[model samples]
Target: MARWPLVPATDAPKNRDPEPPEGEAFPVTSTGLASEQPLRSAAFRWFLAGQSISLAGSAMSPVALAFGVLEVTDSAAWLSAVTTAALVPMVATLLLGGGISDRYRRDIVLRLTSLGAGLTQVGVAILLLTHQHPALLLPLSALNGIFQGLTTPALRGIVSNLAAGRGLQQASSLVASARNATRILGPTTAGLLTASVGGGWAIAADAASFLLAAAFFARMSLPNLPPRTENGPTMLGELREGWSYFSSKPWIWTVTFAFGVFNALNMGVWQILGPVIANETIGAEGWGLVLSARGVGSLLASVVMVKLTVRRPMVPALSSMTLGAVPLILLGVGATTLWLAAAAFVAGVVSEFFTVVWETVWYTHVPERMLSRVGAHDEFWSFVPIPIGQLSTPVLAAAFGTAAVAVTGGGVAAVAMLMPLLVPSLRRIEIKRGGD
Candidate 1:
């Protein structure tokens, strides 16, 4: 293991890079298509291991929770309510969570939040197993959401620390690949556990995964990041600082805005409606296969992204997002399992590609000290509409018909995908090396 010596804020050298000229687009740079494997270091390996364990658990959660809710009451509406309950707090806490990550040791924050999430799930499992009122699960789920929200910014912040300037793209690709691989395994395991033992046991397994992740994270020897240069008077003040930093970069904010709507229409719509369609048209088994195909697509794309490089990354990132609408449209049209699966596979690939490009852009261009807060802003803007979309999609679909809603959402997503390209700054982005 490489020793990470703690450097005090007073001793650390200040960043020497000149800030981009005001009232102009930030200059884009990249590592320019390096095919080297990710750095093999103890800290990086431990961090990756922790993330894999945690993500596997997270992947199982939705399936277990959804089926558990259904077991309690066969109403799709109740399921939505439970999912929304978690999302609301997760979104709400994100800004503050980002600030906290920037202000503290990110790994510690992640450790604590992971522990909280695990315990919260365990509590829910106990409640469910005891045959207590299922309504109790809602508040526990909300508590879990709060921890989930806090985890993101810290995780983002810590990744660069672990990478140690080796290659952010390679690191990001490996992490994405782990997540995608887990998506294939986790849900399938959850389905089996739910069937064989019950939803409670499946959820209990998720709790154990989080505990294991926490243990792995505890072994890391992460470097101490420099303290914030501009400490705000309060949490809100810190958030405003993050916002100022985020908004100053025109390309970043523009893309963030587009994702806000895109996520709403695509992610939100899928979560709310995908299961409904699967239950009605495709059998549950078929839906599982479709989702597995999507995971496979993502896993394959992550592999491609490990080697793929673009001179102008935003072109692919923005253009590829339009593909997200395909599966949604296919589902609305009541397409065959094969057709829906194909479209879903494509959508997943596009989504993963964009994720690599976007993360690489931030890790490369943004100041390391402020990356967590900026990430929070990025996350906040993009995620704000997700819950709204989840809650409202069904209502809108009911009034307008599923086909109309799907097509309209797809149209909006396409527009969002193209709309960012109109910005002169977005069009001009280029990548040289991540964490440059």
Candidate 2:
């Protein structure tokens, strides 16, 4: 890792290269495309190992929780509430927790949150296992949601400090790939575990992932990132400043707005309806195959974008996000057939490509010191729409029908996402594009 200077360095995000005129020659790869960061180093190698374990555990919780809720009560309305109960607190606490990540040693914050998440999982598992007050799982799940909400901004910010400067992009790619890879196992395993053992086993497994995450985070030699500015004296004051920073950048706000609308409609589809569709339509094994197919797609993206030459970072990033809408549209429309779902799964891989590139763009363009706060702002804007989707999907499902609602949501996400794309200032944004 590059030695951290007392004063912060001014490296822009990976994809924010200056753009040339339409007919001009774009800069090709010079230094390299693949990440130059040393992953073989003991510290980062351990960090990678730990993240892998934690993600494996993290994958099991949602499937087990959702299915358990379904087994107890078939009401879609109740399920919506459960989803809301878990998501609201998680998104609500994001900015505050992001502040904490930026101000403190990030690894410590990760460890502490992981410990809490672990405990939440274990406690919920015990409650479910004892067959005592199964209803209590909602509150327990809410607690876990809170930890996850708080962890994301912190984790996203901390990751850059894990590897070398060049490795930053690689780290982002790995994160996306890891998530896709883990999703393939986590839910599949959860389904089997629930089918064979019960929800308790899945939740228990999730708890262990947190404990393992905490242990692994504890050993990191991450550099401390001093905050760029004071968080502020009051809640409103901090919020105003955060908004100021968020609004100052056209690229950031555009991406935030685009995702906000897209995800608001898309999240419920992916989490609730997507799972139900898996159980009823595709079947567990088929769903696993679909998810794995998507994982392979994302893995392909990592291999290609991470190695093959990329030009105009923001354009490709924007293009991927825009293209992402097509796959999502296909996902709901194509749900019935395993072959179609497999195609949709490939669409998901394209979605993930946008996800990783943009994440790297944000982490790189935004000042490192304010990375977490900016991240909180980014997350907050984009995620605000998600809970709305959660609360609304049941009603939409009941009124319009589940398939119709999924189709509508998918359509809405795509349409709403384009509002930002139409803005030339946003679409033309050329931050740090090109390779390492």
**Please, what are the lDDT tens digits per residue for candidate 1 over residues 1-436?**
2222234667543432345432222332222222223456666787889999999999998888888778877878888877888988998998889989877777788888989999999998897677677778899889999998999999876766655333667788899999999989998899999999888888999999998898888887555644555633466766777777788767788889898999899875677788887788887878888887888999999988877877678887889889878888877888888988898899889989999888876776676667789999899899888778877999998998887888788888888888888876666665664444
Q: Model 2, range 302-421, lDDT digits (tens) per residue?
A: 655554334445565555555555544555665455664566555676676677667665555555545677789888888898778776887778788777777777777766656666
- What's the true lDDT of residue 207 in model 2? 92
lDDT of candidate 2 at residue 195, scale 0 to 100: 96
Error of 2 at 383 (Å): 1.6
Candidate 1 ranges beyond 4 A from true positions: 1-38, 72-78, 164-166, 226-235, 275-283, 433-436
- Overlapping backbone residue pairs in candidate 2 total 10
Angstrom error of the Cα, residue 12, model 2: value is 20
Model 2 ranges off by over 4 Å:
1-36, 69-82, 224-239, 268-292, 327-339, 391-412, 422-436
TM-score of each: 0.87, 0.79
- Model 2 / residue 181 / CA error / Å: 0.8
Best by TM-score: 1
